[model samples]
Target: MIGDTPPEASPSPDASVSTGEKTGADVASAHKPSQPQSTESHAKHAGFWALALGSIGVVFGDIGTSPLYAFKEALHAAAGDGVTRPEILGVVSLALWAMILVVTVKYVGFIMRADNKGEGGVLSLMALAQQAIGKRTAVVFTLGIIGAALFYGDAVITPAMSVLSAVEGLRTIPALENSISNELVLMIAGVMLIGLFAFQSHGTAKVGLLFGPICAVWFASMAALGIGQFIANPQILASINPYYAVKFLSEHGMAGFIVLGAVFLTVTGAEALTADMGHFGRWPIQAAWLFFVLPCLTLNYLGQGALALTVLDASQAAGRPFEEMNWFFEMAPLALRLPLVLLAGMATVVASQAVITGAFSLTQQAIQLGLLPRLNVKRTSETQEGQIFVPQLNTMLLVGVLVVMVTFQTSSALAHAYGLAVTGTMVVTTMMAAIVMRQMWKWGWPRVLAFIVPFMILDLSFLSANMLRFFSGGWLPVLIGACLFTIMATWVRGSGILFEKSRRDSVLLTDLIDMLKARPPHRVPGTAIFLTSDSEVAPVALMHNLKHNKILHEKNIILTVDTRNIPRVHESERITIEKLDEDFKRVTVHYGFMESPNLPKAMGICRKQGLKFDIMATSFFLGRRSVVASATSGMPLWQDRLFIFLMRNATNPTEFFHIPPGRVVELGTQVSV
Candidate 1:
């Protein structure tokens, strides 16, 4: 359980090979510039259609498709075979309230406030937590990795359930239904799921363009349906009143809890809106949801309730409203039905794409933080650095989703496993948020409690409901996420211990140079660049270099390549060089998680800084250590093994750090871990 992906899982992306020490005031030479350059600039094009579709494609997948079966299952849970009309409306009303409170008020309105830079996932929040509770960073990192893993679970289940529910709608038309068996429906869904992931190998730039307009149409159609239903029965408007939600809660306490489990389905994908903030920017997503998506969704849910009241027999039709309610079909002509089906299918595919993108982003951050093994990631678009494609992740996710579609067969059965992962993510978010408020913001206890209490209540309600799904298949995802979390924590601890020991034995550059002056020159080297791990220290290789040669290079630069938590930083912020006089320089390079450290490009930038260096005159020195650890080495055996594996499997810095292959020299130092 060290690193999110095992070394065997995938190959490292571009930066996996960085190994050089930075020292002196000129450490700026070590910094690598982030690329596909445009991503560095703010997105200026007001792509309303892309924003609309992308938000819909990404945001609505889990919740948009919930209406297909949420009420049916909740009604069954509440009253079983003898369910009453009032009970159905009550649960439906609860579902509406949960969406308004959790998705609309909490996530869209509030939790979005806690974004870390442009990043908005649980890990980003954990970074905020680190700023808040410095010494207690471990706790926050643990929560983040767990929350991240659970999202993978959600990723697996959301597609299976969404597609199944839509295909299940085919059962409504008796003539059309006879041509499509349920098994056929499941198989078709499985194939579509596979195809959706397969298409991911090709970036979603074009597909993402199609997402907004289709989702806009889908939402508008749903709203139109709701308005029509409202025109028939205005009393259904009461559900929109917060009073009705409070009434449902006060009147039915224990029953309300079970209702909430189903109700959570309405807000399952709420996290996506914030998690994908980096790709779309905060404003576009906010504008799309508030101005377009939310109102339409509210109208549609209201219309469903209004339509329910007009029905004379609710239980006889059970969950299949299309079959029981003829007026709804009459409201839409036959020509529109096929287009609606196509739109729905496309919307689900977009939803899948969003989650897939989220998984990639999460994995990227994990690698940068040393929690995950490096993976071979390729930039899919020249214009968009953020748009990346990871083949291994795409394949694994596709297989997992299709397997669930095959296993569950029906969306309803899959629903039992859906909400738990989302709720778990929400729970961890709240925990990380509390830590952020207390530690980073320096908020008083009362203010922290005031902010966190409501979140805790909401998260606990959903998590408790999801707990009911444990025997129903909730445990599988939690187990997967737990395994991932364990690996991340293990690597973090291991890396910390190794960093500490490396620093302990490190020799100061000044001290080593003084000793070399006692002797004489042995080799021809004008400038030597050595890489160090901890940005503050000089690498031990400097001591050995001078001790063996009995001479100092005319110019010495200690370069430390630092990977920061944020996805991006200003260029002015990139190179912080400290000149340690006596012909020595220390350079610290700042890189965002989203960027790759192309060393040759960094060297070009270094040349631009007026640093005197000859490509032929310089020698790149790297401390290549074969790390070995025993019980006495201060790190646990598991962690030691984990770090060694991480080092062995990591890409060689000669390739990753962009050093001239022939000029680069590595000196081996055997160390007890």
Candidate 2:
């Protein structure tokens, strides 16, 4: 697991297709001179409101479910021997203002404007920053990997936390409140979460239609319940003032700081607004938040505070100490508690879907950027390219979710770990965003600091607060993030060294072509498309064929695939061909990092370019390397073994590149790393 979308899902759209969709990056890109020009908006422009509505479900689900536990956990943490009214006000103030400053201002107002072409996400922004700097610097790469690594932690925890909190609501039902066992709650949550992951392979197109309406209703229900509580205790509205939040933190000492970690949960899913910017565009997510989602969430937290105060007054009148309670579920009138819990479960499920899909999108970007090994990617939807299922990622997420759920037991315990990963990612995002603004937007130091400092302060404050609870549970995400970072860093470094070594030992393509022309071998009839990472060098497979079989194809195409910094590559810019000789040609195919490559589709462009192409008549030659650890390798023994393990587990080139397996010829070579 890594981040929450529409709680943490990335709606990775195409980089090839340009549109005037008013995405976050579009506004920011205006300051940069070299950005791609925008064309007319999509045909779905008529459904502007509809897209906004759908974004509510997919983009804000994770955060929308926060009221289920955020306030309650804050109250629990703030309770020093006993619950107090000021603490209640402080908790509400923190929750509301955290959203306003962190989610509304930093993300929606400023950061969303920092997108890659029309795309937005940790990786998209990372790539955009690289484009800004004119090269991939160590700073941008480190931040990207760190942000992405923390996302997996968020991915694992989101489902566990959201589902657990929703199912935990069952204890508030009158009939079950007295009888429901903790084991039963855990079992129900475990089953539902496992089922959610299982259903992912089937794709969400049909069921996703219901997401908007369901989430819309969930928010409406929350708003209505909150309004009732508001009417009963309108005084709670004062908590929206930032002064109370400031006062609480300043006066309450370490207790308040500990509670701050709990309060950060309110904005845990804020990253989704930026992550899914590509999917729904800037205006829709912004519109959804500014008009609808923000108001509903603010009201709900207010209502929870109001309701908690009411319970407190009643308890004080009864001459008993005021006790912390599950104010979210209890806010429902006794008769509707069960229905509310059911809707909560539905909302949580929907949110979890976003988080999981975010994981898939993040992994896709990671692989495209060469930070990860190629996993088995299966497109679940024929019409929609973004709807993909990664089998390995899915299994990893499911296992991580289950393990987290079992270990945390309740959402309250799990809450400590959630904000750490989310905030760490937020800090990383802010740092990268600063670089993008400085370099891409050409912001001066004073301007960059002025614009980015406040957001950095907020992110770091929350991250530091979460760190206070390291032993309690905050260490989990940190541990997970560190491990992921190591893997990514190792993979990147090892792959770089391997590529350099391979290039050093490989024969030059021009030299090979010249030699072949001088002394031609037995000629074959059809085309031989030899795929390699570097087209400047002759492919190992081609060299093997010439050395062993002592033959050459009549038409040999040296094919190379390169991933672009953009989301998708347009057909016109998909390929380039150079006729090195009558018998040999160099073909280069370009794809956006967000795209899955299909060699056949790329070759289709070759036919239109006066090159004869036939899939049936062509033999695809791929180099298969069996890497063994070497004592003199660039990396240590452990890292060498780890990279080899990753390479061994990487998906087959034919499958990864979407080539026909039938016409593929694998030439194996032993390589030392």
The TM-score obtained by model 1 is: 0.83
Which segments of model 2 are wrong by more than 4 Å? 1-46
**Candidate 1: where is the Cα deviation over 4 Å?**
1-54, 59-62, 79-81, 133-136, 229-235, 242-255, 310-336, 435-444, 536-554, 581-583, 616-621, 624-673
Per-residue C-alpha lDDT of model 2 across residues 28-135, encoded as one tens digit per residue? 556766644543233234456788999999999999999998999899888867877787888999999899889888988788888776788898888877776767
Writing each residue's lDDT as its tens digit, candidate 1 over 578-666 gives 78776778876767666766666676677788776887888888877777867776677877786678667766767556668998878
- lDDT on C-alpha atoms for all candidate structures: 0.68, 0.85
The numbered model that scores best in lDDT is 2
